[model samples]
Target: MCLAIPMRVIAVDASGLSATCEAKGQQRQVGLIMLDEVVRIGDYLMISLGQAMQKISVEDAKQTWAYYEEILNFSPSH
Candidate 1:
C-alpha cells in the first residue's frame, strides 16, 4: 500500500517544475509533474512516487496536519 502525503512547499526553483517540500519538519525535493498549474512557494501539495500529485488549500493543510498529529500521538513508541 502507498499514500500521497500532504506537504508544504518551502522553495521553488526558477524553472517552476521542481520544489522543496516540508512535512513534519522534514524536507524533500520533489517534481511537480501532476500539478494542474505552476506551483509557487508556500503552496501545499500532495506528493507520491517522487511527484507532486495535487495542490491543496490552506484549510485542507490544516486538517491534514491535525490528523497527522493525532496519529503521531497514538503511535506506539519503540
Candidate 2:
C-alpha cells in the first residue's frame, strides 16, 4: 500500500519544482512540480511517490502524523 506523508518544507530549490522537506527528524528532497498552491518554507505538504501533492494546514499536518503513529503501532504476523 502507498501512503501520502505530510512533511514540513525546509527549503526550496532555485527551480521552484523541488524542495527539501523534514519529517520525523529527517530531511529529504521532494518534487514540488505537482502542487497547485505556492509552496514556502515551513509549509506543510502532503507527499506521495516522491512528489508534493498538496499544501496542508498545520492542524492537518498534526492529524496526518497522528495517523502515521497509528500505523506504526500496527503489528501483524508476517
Candidate 3:
C-alpha cells in the first residue's frame, strides 16, 4: 500500500507546473501536473512520491495528519 501525506501549498512557480509544499515542518517541491484543478497557496494537497495527487479539504488534511501522528507515536511491547 502506498502512503500519501497531506501537505499545504506554500509556493507555486510562475508556470504553475510545480509547487513547494510543507508538512510536519518539512518542505518539498511537488509536481502539480497530475492535478486537474488550479493550485494555490494555502491549499492542502495529497502528496505522494514528489507529486501532488489531488487537492484535499482542510479538515481532511488535518484528520490525516492526526492519524499519521498517532501511528508515529504508537509503541509495541516486545
Candidate 4:
C-alpha cells in the first residue's frame, strides 16, 4: 500500500507550480499541480510521490500524524 505523508507548506514558488513542505523536521519540494485552490504557507497537504495531492485541515493532519506515530512506535509481542 502507498502511504501519503502529511506535511505543512513552508514556501511556494512564484508560479505556484510547486512548494516546499516540512514534516518531522524534514523538508522536501513537492509539486502542487494537483491542487486547484491557493496553497499558502502553513497549509497542511497530503503528499505522495513527491507531489501534494490534496489540502487537509490542521485537525486532520494532526490526527493522521498521531496514527502514524502510534504505528511507528508499536512493538510486536513476539
Candidate 5:
C-alpha cells in the first residue's frame, strides 16, 4: 500500500517549479510539475514517494496528520 503523507509547504523555489515541505519534523523537496494551480508557500499537499500528488486544505491536512501521528505512536523509535 502507498502511504501519502500531508506536508506543509515551507518554501517555494523562485521558479515555482519545486518546493520544500515539512512533515513529521523533516523537510524534503517536492515537485510541482503535475500541478496546474498556483502553489504558494504554506499550502498543504499530499506527498507520496517523493512527490506531491494533490493539494489539500489545511483542516484536512491537520486531521490526516493527526492520524499519522497516532500511528507513529504505536511504533517504537530506536
Candidate 6:
C-alpha cells in the first residue's frame, strides 16, 4: 500500500523547480512538477513516493496530522 504524508515546505528554488520539505523531523527534496506556481515556502503539502501530490491548507494539514497520530496510537488485534 502507498502512504501519502502531509509535510511543510521549508524552502523553494529561485526557479521554482524544486523544494525542501520537512516531516516528522526529517527533510526531503521534492520536485515542483507544475505546482511550484501555486506553492510557496511554509505551505503544507500532501506527498507520496517522494513527490508532492498537492498543496494542502493549514487546517487540513492539522486534521491530517491528527488522524495520523490516532493511527499511530492504534494497536492491532492478535
RMSD of each: 3.1, 2.3, 1.2, 0.8, 3.8, 1.7
lDDT of 6 at 74: 98
* Candidates' C-alpha lDDT: 0.88, 0.92, 0.96, 0.97, 0.91, 0.87
Clash totals, every prediction: 0, 0, 0, 0, 0, 0
Residue-wise C-alpha lDDT for candidate 1, range 1-78, written one tens digit per residue? 776788999999988889999988899999986677988889999888889999999899789878877987896769
lDDT of 6: 0.87
The alpha-carbon deviation from the true structure for residue 62 of candidate 3, after best TM-score superposition, in angstroms, is 0.6
- Tens-digit per-residue lDDT, 1-78, candidate 3: 889999999999999999999998999999999998999999999999999999999999999989999999999999
Better candidate number, 1 or 6, judged by TM-score? 6
True lDDT of residue 76, candidate 5: 75
Error of 5 at 78 (Å): 25
Pick by lDDT: 4 or 5, better one = 4
Best by TM-score: 4
Candidate 2 vs candidate 6: the lDDT winner is 2
TM-scores, one per candidate: 0.80, 0.88, 0.92, 0.94, 0.83, 0.85
Task: Say which prediction, candidate 3 or candidate 6, comes out ahead on TM-score.
Answer: 3
lDDT tens digits by residue: candidate 6, 32-74: 7846457788999988987888898989989999999999999
Top candidate when judged by lDDT against the true structure: 4
Query: TM-score order of candidates, best first?
Result: 4, 3, 2, 6, 5, 1
lDDT digits (tens) for residues 1-78 of candidate 4: 889999999999999999999999999999999999999999999999999999999999999999999999999998
Cα error, residue 58 of model 4, in Å, equals 0.9
Worst 10 residues of 5 by lDDT: 68-77
- Model 4 is weakest, by summed lDDT over 10 consecutive residues, at 51-60
Write the residue-wise lDDT of candidate 5 on 15-56 in tens digits: 988999998799999988878888988999998888889999
Model 2, 1-78: lDDT tens per residue? 888989999999988989999999988899988877789999999899899989999999999899889888989989
TM-score of 3: 0.92
| Candidate with better lDDT, 1 vs 5 | 5
Ten-residue segment with the worst summed lDDT in candidate 3? 47-56
List candidate 2 segments past 4 Å from native.
75-78
